[model samples]
Target: MFLRRIPSTIFGIITRSRLSRTIMSESPAKRLKTSPRKIGTHNGHFHADEALAVYILRLLPEYQDASLLRSRDPAALEECDIIVDVSGVYDGTKHFDHHQRTFAETFSAEYKTKLSSAGLIYKHFAPALISLRLNQPVSHPSVELLYQKVYKEFIEALDANDNGINAYPADVAPAFNTGGITLPSMVGALNPNWNTPVDQAGEDALFLQASKLMGETFARKLDYYISAWLPARDFVVDAINKRFEHDKDGRILVFASSIPWKDHLFTLEKELGITEEGNKPLYVLYSEGSKPGWRIQCVPVSKDSFESRKPLPDVWRGVRDDALSEVSGIPGGVFVHASGFIGGNKTFDGALEMAKKALVM
Candidate 1:
C-alpha cells in the first residue's frame, strides 16, 4: 500500500490535461499548429449571458475543443485565446465584455437595447456560424436572413435580459405570473443554491451544464427558423404581390392554400412599402384545405395584439351559414367568429365578397 509523494504542481498539470479535450482541428496541419483554444469567463456565480457566450464560442471550428478557464484572475485571463464577460473590454475580435463604461454597442442603429457578451459575439459570428450549419456560402440569402432573424427572435431577448432591459413598461402589469420559466431564469437556477456548499470543479461542471442547455436551445431555434419559417416568406410575399388581382382596392389578399403567414403578412407589408392607411391589407383569404371552405381572416393591428386593424362587420359577428350570408350580403357564408377576427365561406367568391364588404365596413 506504500506510495511515493509527487509535487502538487506536477499533479495539477496531470489533472488539467485530462479535464480539457485535445480534439483540436481535424486537419493534420492545423492540429499540429494549434493547442486547444482557451475560453475565459468569470468564476464563481455564472449567469446566462457568459454561459451562452462560452457555449457559442465552442461551436466555431477554431474553438470546438476549447478549454474553459473560469477565472477573474488577470494573468490567467490574459493568457486565454478568447475572453468573454470578464475582461471588461469589447472588441469584436477577442475581448467581448459588456461591463466597460464605454460599452454601448447595440446590434445596429435600428436596435436600441445594449449588447451583452452573448449578443456581441453573436452579432460578429452569426453569418459564419449559420453558413457552417446550413452548408451554404456566407453570402447566401438564407444566411443573411437567418442572421438577422435569429438575432431578433432569439438573441435580442437574451441581450435585453442580460442588460437589465424590461420587456414591458413598468406602468403596466403582466396578465399572468410566469414564475421562472425563461431561459435566463432556467440557467440561473443551475447555479449552486446560495446556501449550498460549492467547489471549483463543481462550479465549472454546473457552468458547462448551463452552457449546454443554452447551446441546445439556441441550435433548435435556429433550425426551426431555417426549416419551417423562412420557406413560408416567399409564398406570403407572392400572395401580397398578387393582392390586386383579388380586389381592385388591393385591400384583400388571396392565397391559393393556407400557409404559416400571419407574421409574414406584417413583415412583407412594411418591406414592400405598403405603409399608407388605405393600402394596408384588411383581410386575408385562403382555402381551408382539409375542410370544405375558405377563411377570411382579419389582419391584427400588431403581431401579438388581439385588436384587428379592421374586423369583419359587427352585424355579421356571431352569425353562421345562411344567416351570415344574408346579413353580410355574401352568399355561402359558413360562419363568422364572435370576435370578428375570422370568418368562413363555402366558396372562394363567397370569401372574396365577405372580404370586400368588410374592407369598406
Candidate 2:
C-alpha cells in the first residue's frame, strides 16, 4: 500500500499539480496549449516493477496518451505530471518511490510481501481501472473482487519479483528448474546486453516495448477475470447455495452446466461454512452439452492437492456403460476414470444416485 499520510503543505502542492494535469488532459486543445501528461521514471536498467507501474498508469483515462520521461534529473522529473518508481519521496501524492530506506509498504495488512512500484501504483489506481473495465461503480462487489484477485494473481508477482522475495521457503527447493521463462525474466531480457551500444532513443523504444508487453499482459488477465472468471463464481455460488437439493448429506453439488469451478469451489466453501465433513461438498455433478451425460467429479482435498476427499468406488474404475451399471447396480452408467476421480451417467438422477452409492459403498 502507499503511505497513508500526506503533509498538508505537500498535499496542497500535489493536489494543484494533479489538478492542473487533469484540467490539461480534459481536452486535446488544452493539452496542445499546455504539455501532455508526462510520466517520469529513472533512466537506464529498468525492472519489471517500474515497467508495469508505468503501464498501469497509462490505463487511466488521464494518462492514456501520456508521454514517457526517462531521466534521473530531479529538475526534469519535477516538470512531469506524475512520477513513479523514481524520486526519493513517497508521499502517495506526487512521488511514488519505493527505493527509500523508509519504504515498507505491503498490499494490505493481511499481506507481508513488501510492495514494489507495481504494487504501489496498483494499490492506488486499480479499483477505478477495474471499474472502467467492468462498467460498474468502484464500490461494486464485482469490481472489488476483480481488483483483489488481479493484484494477487498478476501485480503481486511482479512486486515480489522486483523486491527479490522468493516464492518458496529457503528450505524448499523445486524438483525442476521451475522458472523457465517469466515476466521478470522477459523484462530483464529486454534490457541492453553487455557491450551493446546504448543508444538513448533505442533504449527508450525498448523500454516502451517492455512497458507495452507488461500492460497488454495485465489487461488480458483482467479481461479474462471479467469475462470468464467472475461469472463462474455466480455458478459456483448458485450450486453451493443449492447443494441441499442435490443431497440430504449436503456433500454433492450439482451444476446445470459445466463451469470453470475448482477455485471458486474451494473459496466459496470456506466463505459459506462448508467446513464440516457432513456438509462439505465431496462430489460435483455437471452436464456436458456435447456429450449426452452428466459428469460427477470427486472434489480434490484442496485446490492444489491431487487427492480427492472421496474418490468413486474402486470397482467402478475404468468400467463403462452396461458393465459399470451392472457392477455398481446403478443404471445408465458412463465410464469412470481409471483414477476414480470422475464418472458420468446418462441422466442427472443417475449421476446423483452414483454419487450417493459412492458415498456409502
lDDT of each: 0.81, 0.82
Q: Please identify model 2 stretches exceeding 4 Å from their true place.
A: 1-35, 320-323
TM-score to native of every candidate shown: 0.83, 0.86
lDDT of 1 by residue, 108-224 (tens): 899999999999889888787778767689999889888998899899999999999999998898999999699999999999998997888788888878887887778777777
Off by over 4 Å in 1: 1-27, 173-176, 289-292, 321-334, 346-349
Per-residue error (Å), model 1, residue 96: 1.2
Scanning candidate 1 in windows of ten residues, the lowest lDDT window is 1-10
| Tens digit of per-residue lDDT, candidate 2, span 158-251 | 8888888999899997899856599888988999997897877778877877887777777778778888899999988888878888678788
TM-score attained by model 2: 0.86
Look at candidate 1 and give me any clashing residue pairs.
Answer: none
